[model samples]
Target: MNTMVWKVDKYVDNLENNPQVVDAANFLRKNEVVALPTETVYGLGGNAESDEAVAKIYVAKGRPGDNPLIIHIAEREQLKQFAAEVPALAETLMDAFWPGPLTIIFKRKEGVLSEKATAGLATVAVRMPDHPVALALLKSCGLPIAAPSANSSGKPSPTKAEHVLDDLNGKIAGVLDGGVTGVGVESTVVDCTEMIPVILRPGGVTKEQLEAVVGEVREDAALTDEAAQPKAPGMKYRHYAPNAPLFMVSGTAGFLQRLVEEKRSEGLRVGLLTTEENVSGYDADLVLACGRRGELETVAAALYDTLRRFNQENVDIIFSEIFPNTGVGHAIMNRLQKAAGNKLISE
Candidate 1:
């Protein structure tokens, strides 16, 4: 299959009718997949209403069929077609963060979205991306596009077009290169089918932000319970991992530095993933400073690529300092913990 790669602008230039955009949208209409940029991350997209189309996405990414995919829409009015009933909280959140990076799971309208897209469940995950290219693609395609992270399953999500090509160059139809995505992660998933909203996954949207609108929001227990069934995309697998083993340590900078040195003395090539403030404190063979302390958004942006870099350098093991559990920090730690496969050590 010839994978078409096209460069798109941040804003549309008659995008709905652009030949290149049309070609990409045409590919999607024919029950094929396209990797398109969103504010959060690149998604390998297929028409949500078609089983064959959604099936192609899972095959391309080697994603588990049981793990649900998020459907992307062009506007809020599209919700009525897919959802059985949109709750009051869903309306409030849509008003607050649609065309951004928030995903809300709602009860499905019978025979609406394909069963394959919903993972045989009664609910479906959906979001409207903020990127012009993404909105243009969805609008041109004229259908809800069910997409999962474009990377091969259980690996890091793509925040750039190059990252999509790195993992899935020929596996799908094409990629719409809208340059580097802004949020650098996936959407925050809120399950609104219940009486009270429960967060299945944390991403670009923070819990505090959700609470501000909904009054009170709870997190899914499946995030930490290994024996439990996964309710969202990232919870079921060892995701966002690189080739090298990653370990998370919760201790003072001194303790982290000593641990790296101890590993180095054992003839192991160690990689330290730390903050900018403590970059000089680490004595590892390789150090990747994610970002400054207290700026969790910056840290989120660099975390995945840093893991990929350690792989390129062929480090034996990587050590990372954990982040705070509030705001965007929660999402950062969630990805790192999955990348490390929950291999955490305390003070």
Candidate 2:
């Protein structure tokens, strides 16, 4: 497939009427997948109502069919079209975090969306992105779009359009580049099917923030227990991984440096994924700093891009510094742990 690139200004007004967006929407209406920007990450989107379109999304990303995709919408009224029930807490959360980086899973109305998009589950994950270009595309498409991270499955999610082209060029229809996304990671996925909302995946919207909006938010057991079946998009898979084996280090900077030296002694091209404060402290083939430790938000934004950098450098092994699991740090550590495949070394 010839993947066309359509560059549009991120801040342009009346994007729904923009010719570039209209072209992208036309592709989506024809059941072709297109990569569009969201506040969180670039998403490979297709018509959620068409099985053919949804299947193309899975094929483009090589994503497992069983893994559900989140449905993106432009208006809140669209929620009533597909969702059978939206719990009170979900409505409250939508008011607080919709148009941002929070995905809410609700009991789905049968025969509304493609079963393939929801992985045949009884619930559907949905979110309204805050990005104007994304909203314009959604409005133009005028369909519930089932979308997943626009990258090869099990790899780092794309924060920039260039990253999407790097992973998915020639595989999908086209890319509507609206510049870099704000939230580096995917959206926070919350299951509102149950009485008390449960968090299935941590992302831009922290658990603390969710708890602040809707009290007593519970985390899905699948987050920690591999045996449990994950009901959300990002929960079941080992994602955001680099080409090299990454190990999470839990200890002082000196201890991490010692391990890096040992790997270098073995003639391995070692790479260190650390913070700006510790970048100068490490001596390795590649020492990339992913934002500062003091601000976890910056780390979340840079997490995937840094992992992608390791792949570009072709490092033999990677040693990553662990972060405090608080606020956005929870999301930062989650992606890091997934990229490292839970390989943690303590000091």
Error of 1 at 34 (Å): 0.7
lDDT tens digits, residues 141-212, model 1? 999999998998988888888888888888899999989877887889999999889989999999999999
- lDDT (CA) per prediction: 0.88, 0.92
lDDT of 2 by residue, 1-347 (tens): 89999999977788999999999999999999999999899999999999999999999999988899999999999999999987888899999998899999998999989999999998899999999999999999899999899999999999999999999999999999999888899999888888888888988899989888888999988777868887675576798899999999999988999999999999999999998987998899999999999888888888889999998999999999999988988888888888888999999
Q: What are the models' TM-scores? A: 0.96, 0.98
lDDT over C-alpha atoms for residue 300 of model 1: 84
TM-score of 1: 0.96
